[model samples]
Target: MRFRRYLDILFVFILFTKTTFAQGNSCTDDSTAGPDDPHSFDKAFDADKGYGYVVYGDLYRFDCCGTVKRWDFSIGDNGKIELQIWRPVDKKGKIFKLIGFNEYTVTNKNRKSGFVTFDVPDKERLSTEEDDVIGWYAPGDSLIEYTDGTSYDGIWKVAHDDNLKVGDSVDFSGGLDQGSRTYGIQATLAPNTAPKFDPMPDKKISMDINVGTTIYTVKVDDADPADVADLKMEMTTKNDFFMFNTQTGDVIVQSTITVPVGGQTVTLDFKVTDHCGAEGTGSLQVQIDYVGDPNTTPTTTKAKTSKTSPKVKTTITDKTTTDVKTTKETKITETSVAPVATDKNTDKNDKTTAKPDLSTDQDPSNGTMSAMTGGSSVDAALIGGIVAGIVGLIIIIVVTVVCVVNKKAKVRPSGKDPEKANNASKDNAKNDAKDKPSPTDKKPPSDSKSTMNGKPHVKDKG
Candidate 1:
C-alpha cells in the first residue's frame, strides 16, 4: 500500500511538471491551423443538415495551456454553425458533455463556400487529451462533409445531447460518420520567454580602420518558438563616428572614432518582438582600442631638446660662468682688464705676448682660469707702459730747468766788483723778497714798518 501511494504521488508530480513545461514552451502553431489527419476520406456526399450535430476528435494528443481562439470550417448551405467544447467525463475521453461555449456564430449567404472563420471567447481554454472530441452543431438547410479519414471513428447525433458517450460500434444504421472532419482550429498560446542575442563574444576594433567599415553583424532572436516580427538596436550614447543598423543589428563605423584615451567601450540596447507582439531587450558591448596599422611599422615621436639650439645654449652657459665669478680676486682682475683703450692695442699685445684676446673665441672645454690669466697679462703690460712713459717725461722737464739755472749762473758779473756785486745781490734779494711775499712784510698804513739791520721793527705812531 505504501509503494502504491508513492507511485501515485510520483505520477501526479510528473503530470504537473509536464503541464508547467508545456505552458512555458507554448508557441504559435503554423501547420494549417489544426491537427493533422493520418487517414484520407475524399467523400462527396452532403449530410441532411436540419439542426444536426457532428462530433470529431483529434487524431493526435493535445497538451495543456492551449487556447482555441478561432476556427475555419467550410459549408455548402446558407445557414449558421455553432461550436462548443466537449467536457470529458473520464481520463479515456470516451464520454463527454457539451458544457462550455460563448455563442460564436457563422452566417453563410448564397452558397458561401471555402473556409470561414469565427472568433472564440478568451476565457474558453481546451484542456484536452489524445483523441478528445470537439462538437459542432448546425441549423436547418446547412451542409457539412468529411474531407479526410482517420483510423479512429467520430460520433454523429441527429439531435442535441446534454451528455454523450463514444460507444463501441458505429454503423450507417445509426447515422454516424466514418472519417475525420475538415476544420481548422486556430489555437494561440502564452509563453514565458524573452529575446536574446545569439550569444556573441566580445568584439575588438583597431583605431586605424577606415570609416563605414562593418564592425560586426549581430543577430537577435526570441526565446519563444514564435517568429520574431520586429527587431531593432539602439545605441546608449549617440556617437558621430559610429552607426547602428536597426533592422540588421550591424554596427558600422560611419566616421573616424577619435579617442584621447587608448581604449574604451561602446554599448547598445537590442530589442526583438515575437509574432505575438511581446517585446524583450538585451545589451551589446563592443571594445575599441587605439591600434596601429597591421601592414605598416609604427614609429615614436621624440621630444625637442636644447641640444638643437646650440647658440642659445652657449649664451646661457657663458652667462652661468659670469654668475659664478663673484669672488673678490676675480672681480678685481676682471675690473683691471676691463679698461681696454682700443681693440688695436689689445690685438698688438696679444701678438707680442702670444696670448689671445680674452673676448676672442676659445675652446669651450677650457676652464675660466685661462680667460682670466690672459686678461691679467694684457692689463699688466698696459699699466707698465703708461707708468714708464710718465716717468721719462718728468725726468726731461727736471734736467731742462737745471741747465737753465747753470747758464744764468755763468752769465752773472764776477766777484771782482764786490760793491757792485753786493748791490746787485741786494737788489736781486729785494726783488725776490717782493715776489715771494715774506711773512715780515706788512701793509703800509699812515705809518709803515721799517726794517733796520735786516730785522723787522714796529713803527710807533706820534
Candidate 2:
C-alpha cells in the first residue's frame, strides 16, 4: 500500500512541473504584431506555433516555440514607428484635435525576424508632452511623441482606417520618432505659394552726342516677369519721329538739322509703361551743338589814285615865275641908279666946289680950272705931266749911272798911282819914324839883349 502511494505522488509532481513550465513559456498576444498570430497559445500543445510579445508600446514579436519567427509593430519593417493617431488628451482622457503627424523608425542588430514590435495599451500609449506639441490645433491630423523624441509638424496625408489600431504596427513614410516609438500621422504638403515680387520700371536713360553720333542707353534696377515685356523707345526731332527702336529701347536717327557748333540745350521726353499698369514719364534737357554768325564783307574801304606829270608841271611853273620876277626887279634898279652915278662923277670935277683959287690974277678959263680946268687944257696938261715924268725918270737914270761910274772909279786900282799899298807902306813908315825913336836912338836893350851874340833879347814896349 505504501508503494502505491509513492507512484501517485510521482504522477502529481510531474503534472505540476509540466503546468509550471507551460505557464512560464507561454507568449502574450498583442495588437502590434507581424503576419503571425496575435493571441496567446497553449505552450504544452502548440508551442511550435506563433505567439505574441510586445516591444516599446506599439511594437510586437511572434515566437515559434523557442524561436521568434516574425515581429512587427505600429512601426514598419524598416524599424520605423507610425503614429496611428496622436492628439492631446485631457485629464478626463478626451482627445483634442491638432494639425500634423509624428512618426519615426528604429534599427538595431538585436532585432530578430528582421524587426521588432510592441503592443501599447491605452495607458501605455505616448501622451502629448505639452512641450512636444506643435502647430495649430485641428481635426484628423496632428503630431505626437516619437521614439526619437522628435515631433512631426507636416499635414495629414493618410486618414485613420481599420488597418490602423490602438497598438497596430504601421510603417510611416513621414513623421517623428525616438527609438522604436512614433507619433503623429502622415500628411500631404500644400502647394507652395509662388513668391510675390514687385514690378521695376526702366531708369537712368542717357544720350551721348559725341563724334556726331547719338548713343542711347536705358538703365534699369530690376523688373518683374510681367513688366519685362513691352519696352519701347522712339526718337524725334522738331516734333517729327526720325527713327525708333521699339524692342531694345535704342533709338538712332539721321538728323536733317546740322548739329550746332558751339553749344545748345535740348529737351528729350521718354514715356515708359509696363503691363502691370505702371507708368513712368521723364524729360531730360541735353546740351547739343555749337553755332556761330554768318560771314560778312568789310564795309569800310579806301582807294588811293596818283598822277606824276601834273605834279612835275606845277613845280616847274612855280620855279620859272620866281626867276622872271627876280630878273625884272634887278634891271629896274640898275637903270634908276645910272643917271645919279654920272651926275656925281661930273660934280666931283667942278673947280667951283673947291676953295678960291690960290692966285687971283688968273684968266677966267685959267682961273676956273687952273691946270686941271678945260678938257683940251686938261689933256695937254696931262701930256705935259707925262713928258715931265719921262724926263725926270731919264734924269734919275743918268744920275744913277754917273754915281755908279764914280763909285767904280773910286774902287779901281791905277798902275800909274804906284800901287797905293806900297805908297801907304812908305808913308806909314815915315809916320812911324816921326812918331817913334830911331833904331839907334832905341835904348840899349836889357843886358840879355845888348850882347850881339846868341843871347835872348828883351825889350820894354808901351
Models 1 onward score TM values of: 0.29, 0.18
lDDT of each: 0.45, 0.31
Candidate 2's residue-wise lDDT over 1-462, tens digit each?
A: 999788777755754553233212322222122223322211111111111111222122112111111223222223333432233223211232331223444444412333233433322223221112222111211212123322321222222333333433332223222232332212211111111212323232122222234345433321222123333333333433124355655544434333344445556565554322234545444454432221321132222111111000111221321111000000011112211221110111111111111112222455322222122323443433443334334334444454567666876767556476778979999888777866875775554555334675556565
In Å, residue 209's CA in model 1 sits off its true spot by: 2.7
> What shift in Å separates residue 227 of candidate 1 from its native position after superposition?
1.3
Q: Which candidate has the top score in lDDT? A: 1
The digit string of per-residue lDDT tens for model 1 on 381-421 reads 44444433343343344444545576668767765676787
Q: Which model scores highest in TM-score?
A: 1
- Candidate 1 TM-score over all chains jointly: 0.29
